[model samples]
Target: MTAINFAVIGYGGMGSYHIHNIMPNENERIHVVGTYDISGERQKISSQHKHKIYHSLEEVLTDETIEAVLIATPNDSHKDLAIQALKVGKHVVCEKPVTMNVEELDEVLKVAKETGQTFMVHQNRRWDPDFLITRELYKKQQIGELFQIESRVQGANGIPGDWRHELKHGGGMLLDWGVHLLDQLLFLVDSRIEKVSADLSYILGDEVDNGFITYIIFENGIRAIIEVGTTNYTKLPRWYLKGTQGTAVIQDWDLSGEMIVDSGKKNIQAPKPIQAGVGLTKTMAPPSEEATETVALPKITAEYDTFYKNFYKVVREQAEPVVKNEEVRQVMVLIEEIFKAAKR
Candidate 1:
């Protein structure tokens, strides 16, 4: 099989990562032929690495040999870049928050349909090990009928990049990290969202939010609280889930956490009340050791290599894409709802 030739449209952090890290030679299915960046400095860096650097987007688009374009440009540029690539008969792999808004995404989708070119969004968080393990437990009912999930990422560092702090470029934690957590929740719940409430934080005095907290209620009775924080000196668990029989906590990216569940044994002894600050209470006592069991988190065995491989099949064999445009559009719609909820 012939390898599909791809060109990177923006040589920023993620763009470079895709070109260098993800474009594996062993795959023998995809190859990075060249790249384009508006920044001359970034182009120089790419040239230093021996990558063919296209002088402009037009150059990459007009190159007939480049069958696909991986767009990692600013959020505001995604729609135009994607549409241009599709118009020129090039398939497109757009970065997350595929567009600034759903309307923008709709326009790109329409053009993609007209051109009959494959268009896929890079919702890469679906492949994260923490998310994957949580998904597996949710599916298996590891804690028995999961009803609530809390997912978050916190840091003391302020917004890292320049463009990320500006509103015009679609900079904000909601559009940035929130998109990933919300997308992961949507991917796992398997139900439509019935309601949403959100609060966007602007503590840094920037026009855009530094972070946010969103509450989503799924039609299947699952409640998800997703948050992104940049001012946290101390952090909370990366994930906390509650179900009928037990609770699970994933402390951080290292996946350090545990699950404690009620033992199935019958006639378990009730907990004896311990000394309290002032008053004695049997209602707030920890369960007896015999009544519950604590265990290490389940091993994570999820694979993340399928994103590019599936894209290869979609482009080469006309197979269904793993990251479908329709799914991406749904996330955009949800993002709009989140914005509105935050406004309220």
Candidate 2:
């Protein structure tokens, strides 16, 4: 199969990541022919990296060799840039928080339909190993029917970089990290969200949220608590889940965690209660060791390359995208709801 030529717009962190790390390992299904960024400094960096740098976006758009454009620009510019690329008959691979809101995404989706171009967002966390392992457990019910899911990502760094601190660029933890965690939850649950409530933190005194916590109730009776923090020096488990039989926790990005399931063999003595500051209680005691078995996390094969591979398939073979526009739109809807709930 001929490699699909792709031009990366916005030669910043994520753009360079795709160019240096992702594209080099794509098995030749896609090629980055050139790149364009509004900042001359970024263009200079791209050139120094041996990539052809387009002086203007128009030049990249007019290039017949470029079949697609990857938009790693700010969230606010996604809709306009995506629409323009699609209009020029180029397939689009956009970064997360597809647009500022559902309405904006709808406009781009409409143009995609009219132009007969394939569009996909880079909700790449869907490929994260920790998430994949968790998803596997959810599907296999390894811990029994999951009733609660707790997902979080916390960093003590506060919000880094310049543009992310500005409201005009769709800057905030919600639009930034919130989308990834929320999207992963929505993907894992596979049920309609019945209700939602959220609180956005402004601890850093920015116009946008520095962090947020959202509670979601799924139609299937599953409850999800998704949170993102930029000020947490002491972080919580990356993934925690509760189910009928037992529980599972993925402690961090290292995929270090345990799944403890009821052994169901019986005849085990109860956990001995320990004296507390005020009193002793058996209710808060840990389960007897014989009553439950701690198991290692399910092994998950890495599939990061599938995102671009799926995009190529969609562009050339008319296959459905891995990260569909409809799914991304649902995440946008949820983001809006989170904002409203936070305000309240």
What stretches of model 1 exceed 4 Å from their correct place? none
lDDT of 1 by residue, 224-268 (tens): 999999999999999999989899999998988988998988998
lDDT of each: 0.90, 0.92
Leading candidate by lDDT: 2
**What value of lDDT does candidate 2 attain over all alpha carbons?**
0.92
* Candidate 2 to native Cα RMSD, angstroms: 1.1
Count clashing residue pairs per candidate.
0, 0
Against the true structure, candidate 1 has what lDDT?
0.90
Clashing residue pairs in candidate 1 are: none
Candidate 2 structure quality by residue, lDDT tens digits, 180-278: 998899888889989999999999999889999999999999999999999999999999999998899999999999999999976888789978769
lDDT of 2 at 114: 100
